[model samples]
Target: MASNTNLTPPRGLEGLDLLASAIIILDDDNRVVYANPAAEHLLESSVKALSQLRFTEMFLNADSLNAVFRQATENLFADWRQDLTLERSGREPLHVHCIVSALDKPGMAILIELRENVQQLKLDREERLLDQSQANKELIRNLAHEIKNPLGGIRGAAQLLELELPERHLKELREYTQVIVKEADRLQTLVDRLLAPHRRPHIVGDVNIHEVFERVRSLITAEFPSGLAIKRDYDLSIPEFRGDKEQLIQAVLNIAHNAAQALAPRIAAGDAQLIFQTRIARQVTLAKVRYRLALDLHIIDNGPGIPPEIQDRIFYPLVSGREGGSGLGLTLAQTFVQQHMGVIECASRPGCTDFRILIPLP
Candidate 1:
């Protein structure tokens, strides 16, 4: 372990020392020889403090990196390597990807990149859940199909039976038929909703994202003309995207609509503002793909903001923060965006709320 501390290092080491992602370099003994600014912030300790500690104290294992970490290390070839999870705050684990490299001398250097573990776990769990939900949807669709054929026969049979029965008995039999019909209709509605995502043909073409935003703006204004303001902050330089225009409209609408709802009280106070902005981002990654041409769209609202309790499940089906909400809008929006190989992320604070959507162009 290198014990010497350089409060003011050279520019190269200084650059890595200031990264936002958690970064730490360990010697052959796994002692914290050099810890960066990001690592200090991530671990809630300064480099001076971290320099005296061992990596094993923070990471579960340092002697032999786990299979996941080993594979990641091999892939990056030490240009930058990291693949590990650390438990902090005595709470949930954090997923991190790291970049490793050999120092100019004999020791090793590692850079830790942080990612939201909850999101990763949620994605993994939801993948299995999506399969289950898909199966249930298919079953419901088939069942609805099967019931439609027999529903008419059953209703007709009840009518015929009613005619043959006493007037008093006819009423009771008719009620039974009505019950069956009503229940079937209710199931039919659910089936239609479940099948809606799959049945809608994907319309792929060059989409004018600004046009979609304009449509959303007009619709929101139509719905909430009073006490609510819609603002546009678009980057004209952004090019057309390859996507379904209607689906993108709905996807953006759902989020914008949610923002409007959250701004209800503020809208009533005549203090609500919703901003729609677009920009071109370079070296952006969406749905795990690094793309040079990326469209960045942000829906910002000045409102109370989403409650912390339900923020994590905002994209989940049937989960809503508002009463009487079907809770499928955001879920469907997420589904649509994911299909376009894009990502939708939300960040909320007391006075500001932002929903960012990133999609590839060309």
Candidate 2:
């Protein structure tokens, strides 16, 4: 943190230091006239050091900033750039949304506000996802109810029709009835599975995220015993939180199972790998609420990534990238996590796919 005791802040901008957004005031020459505390933190430099440098030295996209500053100063209006990439030397580039406005003060010609675009996008996406999940759950519940009653009747009618057929003369006819009965039963099972999460009462208990990972790992390993390798990188310091242990286990299992299935080709060639990593996420905003501490659990797979066409909708019910996939696995997992007041997100490329589940700690 930078000390403001020795420096005199510009007039009419004394409150810049109190803002959460990084703010920097620039002179007509595009030099740093003032840098707020948040700006100092964001630039990884103290106020004194930043004051000695030009605005161009602070950001790689200095030209874009200069353009915005020129426009604001000349037009005396506010201008903004969305999703601008700010390059830092020896550091990763930051995606930011910047706002520039003419300061209308001597020496301080422009006020620049920079906000982390990725974090804002994540928060916005999470809000939409949470809303979509709730709507999907309600639809599933209603659809299950509409299908359950008729399915039982169809199965019963098939059984009765089978019994009516003569044993020897109509054996083929009886087999047809058997097919109807079997299909009806299968549909019934599907309906039950669709409603399973809502049907069960949530059972809360102390949940160690590592235990959930271990259970999922054991299950996935047992199923794909030959080629795939399951790796664990855990943060044991993470404290236990309140959740339904069984539900969490099932949620993680679904994700790992999906990854294993996706890694089938690599597994055949003996190069498939699944990693379970855990860490403590600080100051995370999940589902619109900010949490000081959250558990960040990642299930990473070295497999062909999720198909781009369906990647965005992977969490929706009945949306699958693979053939004959029910697509309920991710939906159920999302619902389970939401029940625990958490959120899950994914980032994927050609060879690496990461599914991150974040849950608030007690």
Candidate 3:
């Protein structure tokens, strides 16, 4: 047993620490005897604190889960596997695939493991997102390249025609030339933005993510001086990593800006809320690469959530939910984060939208 463990975990329980899924041990009486570190995160409590309560006390759906535990204990060498929704107070319900098996060992009568039911689905979705992001960036860059040459020609021709206009019709015809000039310039600007991510030099340096968060927080607060509330829950233990601070700031700011825009109605009623939360994630997998530690930054907003139909495609270029939106905010943000070898995922419901950015740490 590890000397620092808050609870007297049984011998050999140390093996459980390596698993990514949550694992808990229950005595014959269904009281918590041990919980691995992953379980501590899932339950949001320490092993010592959880030891005081029975396993059933941890969840709203305890009765049914306890029934499974009882069955496993009664039928020696028996095990059960089933999908379950673990509803806990003050937190979101978890949909997991639960397994309960009778353990012959003393003090640890039953072994219970909970794995996210959507684990496979999440992996597939992440792969698809990466593929889609890559294709979108390539297409945008190519299209911008094709558009750039014609735009210069159109603008220059419009300028030349404005100068060459006849004296009699100069006033009327020159206005039409000016329109062409302005519209060409606008499209040219748009093309430049499309190529910006690919063309910009990626500057890498030591990044303290909290500093980035504070910068974004100040920007949002200044923009929405009233009604919107910015709340922060920072994990001060997060270590500095190598990344581009300015790019991170821009990526976070874009998401926050969109969140503030979505909170317009709630802001008007003086109840808008946007929260910034940071935590140190352990043994996380990002972009198919596993890292011992990673930075988990979540930006949450209490606003009318993204429309379900467009949620899946929100990262695609020019996919905006708001009226008059340019729709490039999320696409650019995703691009910048990807540049840092990280992934950004969004989950939203009617009253909440959570944008999580995961970046590997040193």
The per-prediction CA RMSD against the true structure, in angstroms, equals 7.2, 11.3, 12.5
Name every residue pair that clashes in candidate 3.
none
Ranking of predictions according to TM-score: 2, 3, 1
The C-alpha stretches of model 2 lying farther than 4 A from their native spots are: 1-96, 99-116
Q: Distance from true position, residue 283, model 1, in Å? A: 1.6
lDDT of each: 0.72, 0.86, 0.88
What lDDT is obtained when candidate 1 is compared to the true structure?
0.72
Q: Name the better of 1 and 3 by TM-score.
A: 3
Candidate 2 lDDT over 1-362, as tens digits, reads 22222245676667877999998877777777788888888888887887777778876667656666788889746576566777888886767787777877767777788887878667768988989999999999999999999988988998987778887858779778889988998888889889999989999988888888898888998999988999899989888888999999988999999999999999999989999999998998887888899889999999999999988899999999889999999999999999999988999988999999998886
Q: lDDT rank, highest first?
A: 3, 2, 1
Candidate 3, residues 1-362, lDDT tens digits: the string is 21122364467666787788988888877888888888888778899988877888888887877677877888854679887778899987777888899988866678899888786456667899999999999999888999999899999999998888899999989889999999998898889888888988999999989999999999999999999999999999887889989999999999999999999999999999999999988998776778998889999999999999999999999899999887888999999999988899999999999999988886
lDDT of 1 by residue, 96-205 (tens): 66555445434444334454355456455446545644564466468657866675676567566656877778777777767766775665565566457678999899
How many backbone clashes does every candidate have?
A: 8, 0, 0
User: Candidate 2 overall Cα lDDT vs. reference?
Assistant: 0.86
Candidate 3 colliding pairs, count: 0
Worst 10 residues of 2 by lDDT: 1-10
User: By the lDDT metric, which is better: model 1 or model 3?
Assistant: 3
TM-score of each: 0.65, 0.73, 0.69
* lDDT, residue 217, candidate 3: 97
